[model samples]
Each structure stands twice: as C-alpha cells, then as structure tokens.
Target: MKPLALTFLSASIIALTACGGGDDNAENLTTEQVLSLARNTNSANQNYPDSATNELLMKTPEAVTYYLGDGVLRWSTETQIPLYFVSIDGANPPQTLIDGVAQLESRLGDIFTDFKLLTWDVQQYRDTNASDENMGNDTFDKAFFMAQNNLSEGGMILSIDSGYYDKQYSNNAQNMCANSSIAPFSGALQILWDKTGYTYSKENLIWTNMGNNHGCKWNTQTVMHELAHGMGMYQHFEPQFGSWSDGAFDVLATLYHNAPGTKWADLQVSTL
Candidate 1:
C-alpha cells in the first residue's frame, strides 16, 4: 500500500471542519466564507476524513435508532430488502465489500423490528458493450441489468470495479468514490464504486487512510447514503436553518460523520 498521504489528510480536515460543524470557529465565519467553504466541500471531493469520532457517533444508541426508526430515508413499503453487489466486466468485488454490507445490516438491525438485509452476495454482470474509456456505458449497463431483472421491491445494485474512465463520471466533478441513480420509493437504484486506487479495499471499504489515522469509514456509510438517495433523501445544496448548513453534512452526512446531536429524524418527513 502507498504511504498514507498527509496532503489528503489535511485536505479532508479542512473540508470537514469547514462544513461538519465540529469546529468552534465555524460560528465566526461570514456567510460568504461559509458559502465558499460549502462549495469547496461539495460532492466533487470524496476524500473526506473518516475519523474514530465518526465511528463512535454511529455506535451511539440514538444514532443507530435514528436510522432504524421510521424517520430516516428508505423504501417505506419494504422493510426487508436485498442489496445486490455487482462486478462489471469481470471485475471482482473484494470480500471486504460484502463485509461492509454485512456491517451495515448489523448496524441497522435490533431486537425489535429493524432494517434487514436480504441479500449481501455479489452478482457478476458482464457489460460487453462497455468501453474502458467511457464510464457512461457502465451506467447504461447497470440500468439494463436492473431492467432485465425487474428489480422493483427495494434495494440497490452496487457495482465495484477499476475502470479506465475519468474520476468525474457525471455532471458533478466529484471523484468516483461512489455514485447512484438517486431513485426514491419505487424505482431502480444503482451505485458504482471506482476502485482505481484500491483505496476502498485497503480500508476494508469502510475507512480511509489518513496518514496513520483512519479517516471516514464511508464504505458502509456510502452504501447507506446511496440507499438513502434511493429512499428519497435529496441532497441539501443550500444551507438550511434547522438542517444542514451545506452539502458536506446533509441528512446522509450525519450518518458518515460524528454529529450525534443533529435531529436527523426531524430533518425530513418520513414517507412511512
């Protein structure tokens, strides 16, 4: 593995502090400064640090319950869902990827009624029409696969691969940490993970290597994030008074970072 990049670590800290609301100095910043900071922390950059603090936050009873409750975004009708992990063009999804899904399922499950993961196994789909240079084909192929299978209940098709496409796969300039179809309620949802740097697998698909420290363990969070989008949680582009102040820590942001006090359940009305 390459030596932990200190520059990446610094960049993540700057981005998170600017929008995560963890910094005490955030209150002193001007609106212009905050907007500028928000723009900087946009989805384009997926290298945000996943610190230990974030993990602790997720483990808290309130945080787990928040996601398990009816408030968080999800397919309202389907409580038990099957998430299919796909490997495009013969690309193999590591065991860590499956482990990440299992971890997510465990996190959302409880003694009482809770979110259940029906399928965690990876299914291979060969996109013969896909080109190494064109990422759009991957998107098309994923949709094609979903259509062929008639996936309607709930869940998402998550593809993990190392493609020869640019980091920016969509109109947004975001790195290919992951992207989804943003289907909510009763539509097809797909998520793609570009394993170009092997960054995700190295961190077991959960955490990022920030020097000697573990940055954001977004593998599970990324799964939940994409699933949340599929469930109808829209990205917060502007600063909301009671909700997120920026795109960095939107409804899904609270899941990835250490924000225990945020009333995420109250942010959006539950479709359930």
Candidate 2:
C-alpha cells in the first residue's frame, strides 16, 4: 500500500517489455543496475524502454481446458516430502514449473535440507476424474473443499490451469498470480499460474503453462518467492536506501526487482 511498494508492484506486475531473444540488456548490466530499473518506472533508466520489468511478465488469457471434479495428484522424493501436482480437464502442469522448484530446492541446499520435493504426472494415476468447467474462480472455496476432501490435515496445491485469472487480479498486468495465506486452518495455500494469465489465489493453488522460456529469467527466484510466502514470509521489509521520499521497500523486494543470484541463497530461514 505504500508508494514504493505500489511502485514495486506496478513495475513487477503490469509494466514489462519482452526483449529480443528474451535476453534484453541484462547480459551487460550488473545486479544493482537491474534492481534500479525495477525501482524506477521512468524510461530514462533503461536502454530498452520497452523492456520487461522485474521477474516474469504475464501472458494474455486464452482458452484453456480444465479437470471436472476436485482432486489432487500427490508425490514425494526418496526422503518423503509431500509434493502435490494439480491438474484440470486432463491438463497437467508443465515440466518447467516443477523442475524449476527442484532447481530452487537444490540451490537452497541446507535451507530446505529436511524438505525433499517432487511431483508425478496425472497419466500415472487411474482415479483422476478430468473435466472442464467445474474449476473456476472462487478458488478459495474450492481449496478449502479440496483440502477437506484430499489432504486430511492441510497443505498446498499447485495448479497449472483453472481459476479466476483476469485483469482485475493482475491489476491489468500481464503476469499471473501466486497468492497464499499464512494461516493453516484456513484450508491450504492455492497457487494459480497457467498459459492465459498468471493470477494466484490465496486459498488454492492453480496455474496453467510453466517451463523454461515461458517468460523472464528469474524462474528460480519466482518459485522461491512464492514458497517463502508459504513458510510465512508474507510481510515486506523496507530497508532504508536514500531519503524517506525514496519510498517503500521489503526484504523480499529483490524477488521482484532482481534475477536469481547468491542473494537468494544467502537467505536464512530464521530471517523469514
């Protein structure tokens, strides 16, 4: 709600320009310079005034399939970390999103040493009831029901498709959503990101297309950003940089303003 925070959101969510070969000028810029662009909306700061803003830019909405009934496909690693993969209308998550999470976990190393994660394909499951039209917006309600029906305790669900993703959620931006709630009793965390739009709901996890080259170069950072929220890193940290007029800031601001780097790996779970 702060001016700087809104500026961060505006630059992160709405204003973005795709670069040639998806590289932009990032190849030549340092980490600090990129962070500068994310903080400033003025075109003067960037060579490619039309360049995409921090993190992944959102794609436009298109027709997508969905699974009918509410159910979840669960999987885990050799260590037994519960990982659930969501599907809608027979459409499962893209390998890129799941793989990205793996990559992030590996990068975290000791941070999530106790947490090993992995997901299986819906094709391997026989009980899945695929259908379109059943899953829509109001994802919060659906997540509550899914948690009661699937997960006896409560957890998170990642969706590759199905939800209420439009300009309203995106604030007319192009990126999708990755919303979550810190409260456990409120059902489970719902995430939504797909091919059409990238809007995430707080109750249930729903998403569409995800993979390498989908958008942005900070896939690992984006994954970590959402997951950290799951661990209750919901509030933003405003570290002083310049004058008070400089505006708002948060500890996780880098997730939106910069690409994946050592700074992320440097994060301590206790700090969250």
TM-score of each: 0.34, 0.35
lDDT of 2 by residue, 17-45 (tens): 11011111112333453344222322112
Candidate 1 achieves a global lDDT of 0.29
* C-alpha root-mean-square deviation, each candidate: 17.6, 16.1
Instruction: Give candidate 2 misplaced runs (Cα > 4 Å).
Output: 1-81, 89-92, 109-144, 147-149, 162-171, 181-220, 236-272
Please give the clash total of every predicted structure, in order.
5, 33
Candidate 2 local Cα displacement, residue 252, angstroms: 8.4
Report lDDT (CA) for all predictions.
0.29, 0.28
